[model samples]
Target: MPIHYSIEIADAAAHLFAIELTIDTPDPKGQILELPVWIPGSYLIREFARNIVQIAAFSKQKTIPIEKLSKSSWRIAPTTGPLTIRYEVYAFDLSVRGAYLDQTRAFFNGTSVFLAAKGFETLPCSVQIKADSFSAMSKQWQVATGLCAAAVNDNGFGHYTAQNYDELIDCPVEISDFSKIEFEACGVPHQMVISGRHHADMERLAHDLRLICEYQIRLFGEPAPFNRYVFMTMAVGDGYGGLEHRNSTALICKRTDLPEIGSEQQSDGYRQFLGLCSHEYFHSWNVKRIKPAAYAPYDLQQENYSRLLWAFEGITSYYDDLSLLRCGLITFEQYLHLLAQTATAVERGYGRKRQSLEESSFDTWVKYYRQDENTPNEVVSYYTKGALVALCLDLHIRAETQNQKSLDDVMRALWNQFGRHFDTLGQGIKEHEWETIAQAVTGLDLTAFFDMALRSTTDLPLSNLLEKIGVQSQLRLASNPTDKGGWQDNPVPSACTWGVRTADDPQGVKLTHVLRHGAACAAGLAAGDVVIAINGLKASASQFASLASNAKSGQCYQVHAFRRDELMQFELVARDAIADTWGFCKSKDSCQVNKEMLATFLRN
Candidate 1:
């Protein structure tokens, strides 16, 4: 018999979910059950079993003995008939990676609520969502998920079926009095459900999203992968995140990020939100289907390591913003501004000179996810640098073949060869096999390029490659701490540097980081130091930028700070700012050939 589960709100006010699991044909050798330590798409091992507050087992209405095998596994004694287990999970997490519940709404990922029954994981399963268990005042709430509805009420609270345990947990469930808008893209139904208080223009959201979705669908050719898709969002005062699923995605964003009624101009926050959506949607084929060997069959109990995250995540990052430009959602000048900002961010960090992209991808579990104050000095991000690598590859292919082939061709080949047959073949790209595949697709031997881009710590040659696409690259020192690099005809330079980032504090200003080879490091100033006075005057976070910009070079100042409640004093000398900021602009002298290549690159 198939496995079955039923879930309901045990205590809405207390933030608990009651879940019951039943197996009709239990394994005679003591059935085993386990909860996943981490969810896919997120590399961290969160140990979700720690949230189970209470549990028990029964057989034929008789109490059955249960023994703990490990932190996430349990074994029930052999029984003559059907076996059942009931438990209460404390769901208090408010992020996109776990379960959350309260009077406002309820959300959960099956990895945090359902337990996988050993020896029967491949069997089909059914889940019953008891929406009636919610408080009387919340009876109007509706359920939204990617699961196939087997038998459900008008409110979408009833039975759902899954092909196997993997598909069961891949879709997240969101229940609330949400505002929903539905639209069609490429002959497939799509819906976005939002939960929170906001005065958003739902029509504008649907129009812009339809453009992005249709562009991506047409990019990989027709016949979309999924029949339908859902965008489950939770808007709060301030937040930002997204996790991709096979046919849906869970998102969290600041309420202000939503587009306001009667507002036509796009804000930076809104652009960022759109980029997040594009990034996750592209994963529908790049990661969720065309996956790395290590992730083909995820080992949820422990860490899964792969060095090709640069291709999976970084390539997706590169296309997220580019797709926006191609879809006419943003202007060409604004796209260049975004590119310059990314370049400045990657160049400003000193860590890129120390860690290779492969190492960063391999150590994501320990370093990337769990960052520290010294993260900038030791580790680099595979996401930012990986985008640059993809950019270089695309440019190189276009210049070498005179715009005859590009990364777009390579992606289409990947989809046709691997992604189209993933469900049946269940095969993944090997660890060191990407270079070979790219070469075969483009007919170019990229051994030297791959070695420098993936195995070395040196920065990629971006200036030359950008020129081939009719773009000019410029690098200069930041005008101030808040100067995010972009194209400027006449830019003012800062007088000096403090080499420290400060936040508002009750005392005065709290140092958040001390950059290497900066004035703060030279003066022995470290993170967590609260600066009360500078040059015998009061120091504040509001005025710190002006003081740093106007201070004369080679000037000495007396700094007084408190390190963990101890008063201290030091002499700091103002130093010149480092020239690491980047700016990009259209080249006036670009020939017709270069302009044509640029148009070809950005065309939908």
Candidate 2:
């Protein structure tokens, strides 16, 4: 028996969605229903059921007794006939993971709205959307999703079919008067949809995405998996996020992240946005189809733990920016700058010394999502470090095989073995099998490598691996590597560094964050302290920033700051600026080896 859901944009002013669920065959011993605690891709357990403002059940115009079994579950008292469950869900989360509804637009992930009939998950499901109220405002409003439309109108109003509950939830829907365009990648049609205001270069986006998508398709072989793909985005004031699906992805970015119709320069924000796209799109092959064993059949009710998120998300992270370089969306120098920034991030964060990628992947629920000022001091990001690990492995594999093989070969091997055959096998490689599989593919023994990279917190052997690739890495001084300006200036010796990150405040300079183990942290300056003076003279954050930029190494100065209405004074030594920036250059001797290896690494 099929479960059909009818949804309406009811009460858009109040941000409410009314949904009616019909179950044809209910369990004789009471039917169980539950909303997932979290969505895949996003590790946090966002209590989606909390958004249910009201619920009721009915049968033949009579009220049916519904018992609340848990926070997100309910049981319908044994009913011999068909049942109808009607509920209202409040949708206001602005990110890509949940749901949102306003006069301007309506977006929702099915996990936040659809309730699963526990025992009937394997049955087909149908979704019917009624958005009359939304259309009354503007006829241009349309729905965009990767879901299969069974019976629908030109504007995307109608019934959509899914093989099962999982397929239904995997396709998030966006309804708005959005700017949408279509293009083809490797013979597969694709759609790009965006909400919010902007004069985006639609053709430019299509051209770049065409290159990215086509390259990925050819990377694993011809004939892409999905017949169609969709990119649902919401451009906002200043936001960024992405959640991947089987055939589509939901993204959120700042308005400025989109390239202006005539602008030629690609801002860092724009590049980051593109990286988010590549990251999520890559998952179409890595996570969505490749199937992590633990995620093969996700237990949506609880956490499905896996150690290979480093492989899933981490490798994707590594390739996200690398894809840009490979596809010619950005230059090689820019790629190195991005890589250096990631290195600086992992190195500066004191947590890498304390946490391993395996631990970071597992503790995401407790630590990564819920972060504080101490996060940098205590937690290492699996996404960032995992990318580093992937790069290290790529370099190692290339060197061991004498530039004949690279990480690209390893990924294709995995895709062919696991992702390509997911439908037949319904499961994936076990946690303990990756090393053996990698050995078989690359013919290299990676025992010591995996141990240090995943099992222990030892720093990666970056210099040695790059040397084999015919590139050199060196720590240098000057403007911050992540400052978005290309490495155009020479390193100067007089550059001064501070241990504190400051922001301007009405009262004075506010220490928004103080890096641990730096001069500021050692001198007792903490986050949230307002610095009113330097050497007893008034200074704003900007003023102090200028003074510190030209500061000489190893100097002492009096600091005056206030901690919650208590003024204090402390003497601190000016340490040399942290030499964390790494500059990558082609070894003058092996320009040919560098060219060959780099070409092999970038090729599909």
Candidate 3:
């Protein structure tokens, strides 16, 4: 029998959702019900079942014996036949990974709200949504989701069907008086639904979004894959995140990031929001459809590791911004600045010296998601470095083939090889398959490049690789430093550049971090130390920041701070900034062919 489910806001004030699971046929031994311990997209295993409360099983108004087998699984003794399980979930977690509810709105992911029947997982399931009856505000709420329509109406409220339980949860439902606008890309209908009480410029959003969507579709040589797609965004006071699904994505952004009415100028916040949108949208192809070997069949009971996140997340990240540039959402200068910013961020981090991209991908469950104070000192980011790997590969292919083939060709080849055939094969790309395909597509043997990038913690040769893309580079300080011994003996007591980050508290300026080799560490100032004064002067948060950049070079200062309420002082010398300069310009000697290749890359 079909596995059927229904979800409703039982109590909006308490943020509780009532869920009912019905199975028309029960296993002769017993009926097993389990909620997922985690969701895809986010690597961390968040115990989603812990939120379920007050569960009961009934076969025909007769109580069936219930037994808890594990953290996420339950079993029911055999009864008359069709078994029904009713439960209430306390859905207050506001992030995109789980369920959330309030008088203002309601949102829930399938893993957070649906209970899967063990034997019927592969069978079709249906979700029936009920209107909120918990509060006056919920009365006016509407619904938006990506689930295929079985009995749902135009307002997106009612029954939705999925091919299986996996597909059921892949589409999250949002209910509120959100602003939803429909647009078409490559003859496919797409919806952008924003949930919040805000004045967003939907016209501009749909216009720019169409361009990005069309560019991506054209890039992979597919008119469209899904019947319909959705962008379910929650605009909040301050937040940023997204989780991708098969046909939709759930996103959260600061309310100010949305386009305001009558504003033609795109703010940095709006650009960042657009980038977020593009990032998640690109996942529809990269991570969602093009399955990684480790993630081809996710084991939601525990952590799943893979060394191809760089290929999945990194490549998508590389293309997200590039797609924007290709679509003319931003200028060529803006794209260069974005590239430089990414390079600067990756190079300055000391962790890149300790970990390789493959290691970073494998250890994400332990290191990337769960970070410590020493994270910057030990861990490298697969996303940033991986994007560089993609960038390097792009230039290598272009330079090798003399601009005849680019990374765009590599992606299309991958799509044809893995993505388009993912459903039937269910086998993701293997680790070695990357080089094999790159060689087959670009005719370039990249053994040395891939070895240096994935196997060792060596810095990417950006200066060398960028030359292929017609961009010249130089190593210089991101910021200049004052010459030593250039200050007077009593140099008006100015501040100088120091490498300490601080925040404000009632007592004084609290040290947030002391860079590994910075003056603060040299002076023994710990992370929690509050600086009450520096050199017998008041050290307020603002005052300390002013002095940090303006202070004299090589000057020793009598710094006084509270180390856990104990007064202490140290003689700290001024140091320069610990940041890297990432500026790229067109190579002076770049031939016309190389220049045209660069133009084709950025302007395509």
Clashing pairs in 2: none
Winner by TM-score between candidate 2 and candidate 1: 1
Write down the lDDT of every candidate, Cα atoms only: 0.90, 0.85, 0.81
TM-score of each: 0.98, 0.95, 0.93
* lDDT for each residue of candidate 3 in 355-442, tens digit (9 for 90 to 100): 8899998999889888776677678888888888888888877777888888888888888888887766777877678778878888
Q: Of models 1 and 3, which has the larger lDDT? A: 1
Instruction: Return the TM-score for candidate 1, rounded to 2 decimals.
Output: 0.98
Of candidate 2, the 10-residue stretch with the lowest lDDT total is 480-489
Global lDDT for candidate 3? Answer: 0.81
lDDT of 1 at 569: 98
lDDT of 1 at 52: 91
Query: Which has the better lDDT: candidate 1, or candidate 2?
Result: 1
Best-to-worst order by TM-score is 1, 2, 3
- Which segments of model 2 are wrong by more than 4 Å? 478-489, 552-554
Which candidate model has the greater TM-score, 1 or 3? 1
Q: Name the runs in model 3 displaced over 4 angstroms.
A: 132-139, 478-497, 586-590
* Residue lDDT tens for model 1, 107-197: 9999999999998887899999985785343867999999999999888999999988999999999999999999999999999989988
Highest lDDT: give the candidate number.
Answer: 1
